[model samples]
Structures are given as structure tokens and as C-alpha cells.
Target: MDLLSDSALMLKVKSGDNHTLGLLYERYKKRLFGFFFQMCKDASLCEDLVQNVFIRVLKYKHTYTEESNFLSWIFKIARNVYYDHFKAAAKNKASDVDELYDLKSSDNVEKEMEQNEKMMLLKKAISKLPDDKKEIILLSKIKGLKHKEIGEVINCSEGNARTRVHRALNDLKDIYLTLEKR
Candidate 1:
């Protein structure tokens, strides 16, 4: 038999077939993990957030509508999960710091070092972005979301989303250049 659509599987999940929820998890796990990892750069935390997203999916399956785009709906949940985590962590602690990415060892040590330096600079630049700008970049550039979809998630018009993404890119470019020059 053919694989069911995400909405179909989700409907199954809504109807009390919990097994279908597993199928939905399997389908979205990688993408959701990538989204979370790019935002926070923490493997362990990303794993937790991805689990939480699936949990929320099961928890709120009844709220999902057939007319809505499944990907957008799930991403909305993912965004809320992230904000909830952020807020909770903020309340528990004064600061939330993310560690830099680890670089792999290679035979060309100089090249590896230079590449790692560039990656570190890029990540730092991205980290410095205001939350709104960073989120737009992650959703549009990193997650490969369309302007319309991004607008839906961010609660803006499509044109506004496009404009915000453009400005964010320009800001990121400036920041990256400044960091590179150091």
C-alpha cells in the first residue's frame, strides 16, 4: 500500500490510532531536528525539542484541521515549543548560552582550522542577530520555507515577510563581513 499523506496520517492519529503518530514522528523527526539544531546548535537539546514537538502533536491532534497545511501547522507547534523552552529556561536561569560547533580533525590541519574559524565566525554573526531577524533567516534560508509559509508562521503578510527576509539577509551579510574582518 502507498504511504498516506501527512494529513491523512494525522487524521488517523486524531481518531485515536496512536500508532499513526509514530509514523508522523518518523516522517518529521529529521526535519524538526534540523530546524531545532540550527536554531540552538545543541544536539541533546534538539533531541528533546523534537520529542516535545511530537508530544505536542499528539496532545493537540484534535486542533489540527484538514484545510491547514500540515508542515506549517507542525512548524507553528515547533516554534511554540522553542519559545516555551526559551521562556522556561530564562525563568530558571539568568542566561542561556550555546556552545560553538565542534570541528572534525583532518589531514589538512591548516585548511581545517581556517574552515572551522569561518564557521565559528558565521555562527557568532548569526547569534548576534535580533530574535526576529534570526528567526526569519532560520525559517526562510535554513529551513527552506517559502515567503508565504514564513508569513503564516510569523503572522505577517507575504510581502512583509519577503521584505523582512531581505533586510535580515543584508544585516547578516554586514555582520558576517564585520566578523570576518576581525
Candidate 2:
């Protein structure tokens, strides 16, 4: 299959082309997995969430419009999937340990330890943010979505999205600093 834009791939998927959906999955699985893992801290549940996003895409293919940003649309579905899971899991009191992604081997164990410590603190700081701030930070910084795309995902105006991201980052910095001092 030729390399197509995400929208083109989804347009094909909209027309009942299952192969295109697989292509989309291959393109986005890691990103979706990372996003969910960061939010939920569970490898197995994040994997399930990634699969659920694809299932949702297939189920709601008809709702995708040519003008819609695929990143925003897909992430919005992912966000809903996560929130739905969170609600159910909350009712069940489910929680789990932090999921580790494959880390490149370092020649220096001390350096690796320091890096891991910083990462742990950052994750804790992110977790401390309000849900809206956390979602904005995840969408803007972690997922690399532009404010315009984030606005679509968050259902806000572009300017509002930009402001939200700025606030979230500032809040993150404050939280990280506070945690670093601990």
C-alpha cells in the first residue's frame, strides 16, 4: 500500500477497507499505547485501551469528516475510552504499578538511575494535575498536538487551547519543583 495521509487512510477505512485500518493501527499503536500508559500506569490496560480505540474508530467510521483532523479525532476517541475505563475501574477500585517501556541500555548505571528518578518525579507531578490540566498536557506535550488540534480534542477555541497548555505547563513546572524538593 502506498503511503497516504492519515485522513486518506481513514477515508479508505470509512469506505469499508479493513486493510487501511490495519495500516492506521500500525502507524499509531505505539503513540496510543504511550498515551494510555502515561495516563493509567498499567501495561495490560493500556494495551487494551489501544485496541479499544481502533474498535471505536471502526465502529464510528461514518462520523469522520474529510475536514476533521485525524489526530484530534483519534485522540478524542482515546480520551473517551480512557474516561469510560476510568469510571468503570474506579467503581471496581482497580489500580496497578507503573508500566515500563523498553529503555535503551546505558553503560553507566548511575546515570540511568538518575534519569529514572527524574522520570518518576515527572510522572508523579503529572498525576497530581487536575484532570483537565493533565489531559491538556498529555495532548499538547506528550502527544505533540498543536494548540489548534488540542482545541478540537478538548472542545475549546484555539486561543483558549493555547492558554490552557501554557497554564498546564506552568502548573507542571511548579509541581515538579515541589516534588524535586521533597
Candidate 3:
């Protein structure tokens, strides 16, 4: 079923339909897990967070409003889960070693090594940006989110999201130039 039709299924879920909820979980599991994996840079942690997000959704299903965008609401919950995990990790002084590895695998390790080098340079450039700009860039460019969707995720206006993405691209270009000079 299409995403719009999923709203009807969600309504069923709200009214205590276990089968509809299971279907919804099956539909979203992979995408939501991928989002968590990227954000956490840890497969195990991503799995845990994904479970927690769905658990929270099921527990609080009564609070979900028909006026809200379903995917956006789900993502917001995922985002909050990510932030909570980050806060807890920081408190515990945990290190994320998985962040150092590329998520993709290739047949040629040499070519992958070259790509990783470039990625490290790009990551350094991204690190130079202010948090807001970096977030917009990551969501828009890397995650392939629309400006409006990103605006919703970041709690900004669409125009603001567009402006920040534009500026972030310019900043990234400048950083690339600096790296080229070095």
C-alpha cells in the first residue's frame, strides 16, 4: 500500500489492531534501521534504538495526531532517541569506533582506501561548519532529504532550510578549495 494509505492502517493501529501495527513495522523496519545506523555509526546500537523507537511509538500511539505527517513524526521520535543515546554515551564516556569505517564494501580494497581518504577530507570539511549548517547539509545532500522535509526534521521553515543548505554548500566548496591547496 502507498504511504498515504498507511494512514488508514495507522488509524486501525490506534484502535488496537495488532496486525496493522505489525504490517506497519514490516514496512518501516529497514528504512528506520538504516537511519539509526547512520546516525549512531553502530549496528548494535542502531538495532537497539530502532527497537526503542517502535516501542515508544506503540506505547504512545494514542498521542499521535491525524494532523501530523506520519513519517515526520516517526523520524522525530528516531531523532529524539538518537539524541538520548548520544547524551547517555557522553555521560558514560563511550567512544564510537564504528564512525571511522565506511559503511559500504567494495571488491577492491585499494580503491576503497582511496575513497576513504577522500571521505576523511570531506568529513573534516564538514566538521568545520557550524552545527546548524552541518545538519542541513547532511540531511539535504547526504541523506537526500527534500528541503521541506529537512525543515520539518530540524524545526525550521522551508525557506530557512533552503538558505542554510545553500550557505552550507558554499562553505563546503570553500573548504574543498583549502584542502586542494594543501
Stronger candidate by lDDT (1 vs 3)? 1
Q: Quote each prediction's TM-score.
A: 0.82, 0.80, 0.71
Scored by Cα lDDT, where does model 3 land? Answer: 0.71
Assess each prediction's global lDDT (C-alpha) against the native: 0.82, 0.84, 0.71
lDDT of 3 by residue, 12-112 (tens): 77888856877778877777787765444578878888889888888878877777666666777777777777777654323333466445766678988
Expressed as tens digits, the lDDT of each residue in 50-152 for candidate 1 is: 9999999989988988886788788889999988998887532222323455556667788788887788777778777777688788788635479988887
What is the C-alpha lDDT profile of model 2 across 6-93, one tens digit per residue?
A: 9999999999897789889999999999888767677898999999999999999999999988999999999999899878765432
RMSD of 2: 3.7
Comparing candidate 2 with candidate 3, which one achieves the higher TM-score? 2
Give the higher-lDDT candidate: 1 or 2: 2
lDDT for position 171 in model 2 = 95
Give the per-residue Cα lDDT of candidate 3 at 59. 83
lDDT of 3 at 150: 75
**Candidate topping lDDT:** 2
Clashes of each: 0, 0, 0
